[model samples]
Target: MATLNKGILGGFSGKVGTVVGANWRGLDIIRSRPKNAKRNPTEKQLEQQMKFKLAVSFLQPLKTIQSMYFGSGSGVKSRVNMAVSYTINEAIQVVVGLPELIYNKVLITRGELTSFQNAVLTTQPGGVLHLEWEDNSTQGNAAPADLVSIVCYCEELKNWEIFEGIVMRSDLMADVTLPAYCLGKTMEVYAFLNNVKQTAASTSFYLGQHLVN
Candidate 1:
């Protein structure tokens, strides 16, 4: 019997009439199937696989947002792929509870929103969210009168509170009182500055989650 070697498109397979295909590590090629016996994966290996699966499932829904905010390359497809890879890797690290995974939120793509300096969020005793930032409008593209938009998400209740079009960079600070139901739960906060025309916005910054105080 004669054996033929095909290109990467042909994956490995058992010999059939002297032709076979095989794929390895994403490369498709022609090869004969190995005769080694298969063994069950170790517990650690299975756990890692589960973590990767969970990470993918959690990040699938955010693909649009990722592409919109994280797209950086000259080509759309490359930008999207980079964003997906970033999100997936972040999710996997977080799922595995890595000690370095201190930030639970996804990394925000830096953009026009970089004008604001030292944005901070704090929870007041009365369950009020106090957002403050140093206005660097003169140094950056944003104007002092640019609109500020804030979003708060309560993870436990799956509730969202949005405060938009009511604050400006000139104000330097804003306060948002949480509803009674949102008290005692952890919430994630995001903030961004938008142009006066409302046609453009800076990158949304994750201000970290806080337990309602």
Candidate 2:
């Protein structure tokens, strides 16, 4: 119950007489070890701890992306706090819809299409993916040459397949061949466009998930 101010022993580690020294929150302190409690944690308390552990494990890998888009000039601690809060509030089972960070601008995460319209996906023989979309080049934000980026995730394999290429705005269709192993496994697809000249990117569109056939 005593706060050891710095000027005292200047942070002693190990046991010194009856006092044990340690560092906590960047501060040096000394305290006596308390006796272990006899009662175990309740079920609800254990569940809460499990949720926290899950959140940390889930968000650890996305540290780079979260810092890129949601840092907001704050340190990594801020982003971690946000991710933890979101995970707890929503009880997120799968991680998706992370916002894209481009040219210091944050774009929407939910993948709402704008310049591209009527996107459709169909599975062809041999597990080929046929993607078709209407070209709305007349949109003010549209450009003559844009880069299309597609990301698909195979939950069964815990793998992500990315495809990106420069395409003329007039083109309305594209195709991708799923790996033989990915056939018949449900996969989620997301598509977005990047205007390289302007260094801007469009909001991603979630094309939904289905078996590749």
Candidate 3:
């Protein structure tokens, strides 16, 4: 009988191929020695089952080793590493939150206010709420603090309500601290972006950073 060599065994990798070879060998044994075979069909079936089961049992440890590289072995570790990389990248999202507004009817167009050319809304703490664009001259041509209007909004009794108004330029960014009081068990809290200009003015909300909690 030609023995299974190290080179041939390497190809098994503890998959279906290992059982296939064992099944073939068991069939050959039965065919070559039929006179002293098991008495019934069920016994012959059991013999075949035992052959495959023994093959699997012998390869179980090798299966564990191979699976660690390709499958579930290090899923948690890889995910943790990815989370750490994101934290190190400092890709956090920040927003200045809604501006202050006394009335709900007023609207501020993104075109009229020219300091911060772009605005991003986010859910991070201690992050910049606003940014401004400047010409290459490094000279600021912005209006006074009283001239810039920030329209703010808050939720009241399940309705969008206008809050106070503020005159601000670059110095009026507000940090929305985490709510100190928990009202009750709730799925989500509601807030609104009031007085957002409809024409040529747009604000984008997105997932900025991937961080580990």
Scored by lDDT, the top model is 1
1 versus 2: better lDDT goes to: 1
Descending-TM-score candidate ranking: 1, 2, 3
lDDT of 3 by residue, 1-213 (tens): 333434664322222322322235433211222244555668546544544443333223323222322122245544223322222222222224212222222212212223343333333433212322223122233333322222222223222111222323333343333232212211111111112221121111121221111
After best superposition, candidate 3 residue 28: deviation in angstroms?
Answer: 99
List runs of model 3 lying over 4 Å from the truth.
1-115, 125-142, 146-158, 161-163, 177-213
lDDT of each: 0.65, 0.61, 0.27
Give lDDT tens digits, candidate 1, residues 51-110.
556445544544444455454455646545665456555634534443222235454332
Task: Between candidates 2 and 3, name the one with more favorable lDDT.
Answer: 2
Which residue runs of candidate 1 sit more than 4 Å off their true CA positions? Answer: 1-74, 78-83, 91-105, 158-160, 197-200
TM-score of each: 0.57, 0.57, 0.22
The number of residue pairs in model 3 that clash at the backbone is 6
**Which digits, one per residue and each the tens of the lDDT, describe model 2 over residues 63-177?**
5434433324355466457656555555443224222112112122222124568888777878777788887877877765776766676656866666766355568888888
Tell me model 3's lDDT, rounded to 2 decimals.
0.27
